[model samples]
Target chain A: MLNRIRCLLIKELTQIRRDPRLFGILIMAPIIQLVVMGFATNTDIREIALAIRDNDRSFHSREYIRALAASGYFRVAALPGPVAGDARQLVAGRAGLVLVIPPGFGRQLVRRAPATVQALVDGADSNFGMQGVNYLNQATRLFSARFAREVAVDARLRGLALPAVAAETRVWYNPELTSRYYMVPALMGVLLLVTTMLVSSMALVKEREEGTMEQLIVTPLRPMEIILGKLLPFVVIGFAEVTLALPLMRLIFGVPLRGSVLLLYALSGVFLLTTLGLGLFVSTLVRTQQQAMLIAAFFVMMPFILLSGFIFPVENMPPAFQVVAQFIPLKYYLTIIRGIFLKGVGWHALWRDGLILLAWGVGILSLAALKFHKRLD
Target chain B: MLARAGLAPALPLVTPAPRVWFNPELESARFLVPGLIGMLLMISSVVATALSIVREKERETIEQLMVSPLRSEELVLGKTLPYLLIGLATMALILLLGWQLFGVVVRGSWLLLGLATVLFLFAGLGLGVLISALTRSQQVAFQVAIIASLLPAIILSGLIFPIRNMPLPIQGLSLLVAPRYFIEILRGVILKDTAFVELWPNFAALLALGAAYNLLAAHKMKQGL
Candidate 1:
């Protein structure tokens, strides 16, 4: 049985090696994607174009504008002459944020009266708009505290103390909140899914389409041996992809792998079983390689990436979607990847995710083997 | 402590009152619907055109067509026409669904939007035919079609990720991606109510891309023949 499987494996590898384009796609595509996505995927939105309508033209308003620019979150765009006209910049997408400092003349601040500034935000992209609002709030709070402290110092000479509440915020794990730190680790799951699933699902379908399935079935190898043999080459390819991706992720992208490398590889082994099984299952259901490719792409890969909590947080998803997300294998892998990469947690912290992945691998692979066997018969 | 202190309470000197333009309520559906429409049209057109030529080759019908008096241009057009109608019908259906389900009404010129959709579909279908011409098997065609059309539409087109947030080099690279321009047209027409004066640049870009892809596909089809 081992000898038969070895023969099948060698045949599969030889066929794959003969196709230079397939070899290039299997090896080179992930590296290109990694480099491109490393530069492309960013959520740390900075340099938001801010248009300031300083109606007051007061020293305080100028100082506020200066402070906003100093925060490194905003750059003041060149707006039209009048405030009403400049608001068009938001619609034109020339500015993402607009601050209208009302005509307070600095009198209200000296008299300790409430003043108001209207901030018109281009909310076509709500996530970025909301982040902009949060950053603006923090900068404003900091600016107000500084002003209040100066006022308090002046009042202290006349024997008066001012009330102020200071907020000290500490962000754990990602202190600077660099988005690449989060995105690169999640990208590993996405890249692996694309390459492994594409190659594996197309494997059996290609054989059947090329009219070679009968030749294989006529051989003495059993269904289980054939299935294992077909999957083994892709398993090696998937692992090679991971090994290539991980070091680049660590060295080039600077995403730290804090957990044991052995544990990561072991967990990835279990994860590959699920993905490879999924590809095989897709192959069984379709008559043609085209159908297999379409089903694998639109049905399997799309939902996996979307629900993986790679880009959007699963916590923020609706209740029903959150439930649906629990079924996606990538969801479990993402948690393991993120936890291992960022939190540096070992099997103790991530054992549940590991166990779930193991279950999924077993369930999916068995179903695929059963389906493939029935098809063969 | 500040409220209790005798010193005048330091109230917020400047309050930020935000007004979300184009989408006042900041509805994500409004932004998503148009981009979704672009994505749907892209997948349908690309896949349909990709399979058209490859299916013939798979069934060995290309030999019959090759010996016939049909020109490559006519063959290309014949293959593309049905998918073009399908693309138009799918676009209309999605727009209707978008209005009914998401309250996404087209605010700008429908004429411009229709033109842009047609041009975008042309570019996508041309790329599909191009992929079909290059690959020998249906599997390679399908994989190439998805990889070529879908990934770029999702990533580089600003469907989910804002192009502005990407690094400068990637942002520049996005200009070659067709859906980037189409998505802009959809959002501009549907949400922002942008006029043709503001949208002419996008229109020009789509036309150029459509002509480029179709010309390339036509040239490749001739070579294959």
Candidate 2:
């Protein structure tokens, strides 16, 4: 049985090696896809366009506008007109935020009286509007503090303490809140699914389409042996992709590998079984490679990426989606990957997700094997 | 089309609330349909055209066509034209459905929308032809089609991720991607009621990319790839 499987593996590898273009694309496509998309997924919304109508046009108002721009979150554009209050920028979609600073302006600030600045946000983009509000709020508080200090100094007063609740936040794991730090590791798991499941699903379909499936079925090898033979090479490819992607991710994107490499490989081995098995199941359902590609992509791959907590937080997903996500092997693998890469925790922290992934591997691999055997018969 | 598109951005309205315009209820469909159109165009144009051409090669029908009186350019046109028309038909259906089912209507000019969709179809079909020319099997074409067109279009096109928020370097690179302009035009027309004057640059870029890609595909077809 082992010998028969080895022959099949060698035959498959030889075919892949012969088609260098496909092999080259197969090797590089997923990594390049991962890197390009992963790098672009900076969820931190920065550089939100702001159209500010500075009513005061005072030194302090200009200083305040400069501070907002310097924070690197908002791009400030000054409107020459008075506080028209109509928010033309928002109406036109040119800017996500609009600010109208009242003329009561510098005098109120010099006396430490209440200073009022009106803000108008475009609600058309919910996420952008929310983030812009948050950043603007923080920037204003900082600017106000600085202005208050200068006023106290000019008056020759020793101390002016404004009572407030200041949040001194210390973020752990990903210190800078860079979305790349969050997405790159999650993308590693997504890459495994794209490379392995789609490749394996298409493998048998390609054979059937080429009229070689019957030839393979007529061979002396058992169906289980053939299944392992087909899936095992991709298992190797999946590992090689991860192995290659790891250092490249580190070098290019500065994605840290905090956990033990050995441990990651161990968990990855378990995850591949689930993906390969899912691919085998997909292969049994398709006639042509095109059908295989579409089904695998739309049905399997899309749902996996969505539910895997890669982009939208799985916790934020509705209860129904959360329930459906429980069955997805990629979901478990993601927790393991993100935990290992970002949190640097070991078996104690990750054992539950690891265990669930292993069970999924065994469950799905058996189910796929049964289906493949039935198809062969 | 050009005059209407050029004249539209000249007028501006004052919103009662800065956050919500046009969409008072904030129906997710209003935000989603434009991106959906962009994604569907990619799948149908790139995947459908590439698959159709590669299927002919796989089934050995291309040899029959090549031996016939048709020139390679005509063959390319014959092959891609149906898909382009079909893509437009599909876009129209989607617009109808979007309005009927989701109440997400196209506020921009229909002529401008049609032109953008046609230009985008050419760009997508060119990519399909290029992939078909490169690969011998449907499997390879399918993989390459997704990687080269669909993935980049979805990610780099500001369909899901806003292009304005991207780092300037990535934003610069995104200019090479055709769907960026298509989706931008779609959103401007569909959601924000943006006029053609505001969107002429995007339309120009789409036309250039479409011509470049189709011309390159023609060159490859003549070379017998």
Most TM-score-accurate candidate: 1
lDDT by residue for model 1 over A155-200, one digit each (tens)? 7777777665678877665532467877887888887877778877
Tens digit per residue, CA lDDT, model 2, A1-377: 88898899999999888877777777889888777777677766778998888778787778888988898888888876545635556656777888777786766665556676777776555566667777788787777667644544544453333233446555465523457887788887887787788678887778888899899989998877888898888888889889988987898889888898888999999999889888888888878777777777777876777667766788987899899999888988988998899789898898898899889888877777787778787
Best of the candidates, lDDT = 1
DockQ of each: 0.50, 0.14
Q: What is the C-alpha RMSD of each candidate to the true structure, in Å?
A: 3.0, 8.7
lDDT (10s digit) by residue, model 1, range B104-208 = 888888898888888888888887887787776675677677777766676678887778878788999888788989998888788777777777888898889
Docking class of 2: incorrect
DockQ of the two-chain complex in candidate 2: 0.14
Per-residue accuracy of model 2 over B1-225 as CA lDDT, tens digit each: 565444322211111123445565555556767877887787668876677667878888877877888777777777788888899999999889988977887887889899899989988887788778767777678778777775676678876677776767788889988888888788778877777877889889988887776777667767763
Candidate lDDT values, in order? 0.80, 0.77
Each prediction's total of clashing residue pairs, residues at least 3 apart in sequence or on different chains, is 2, 5
Chain B only, TM-score of each candidate: 0.90, 0.83
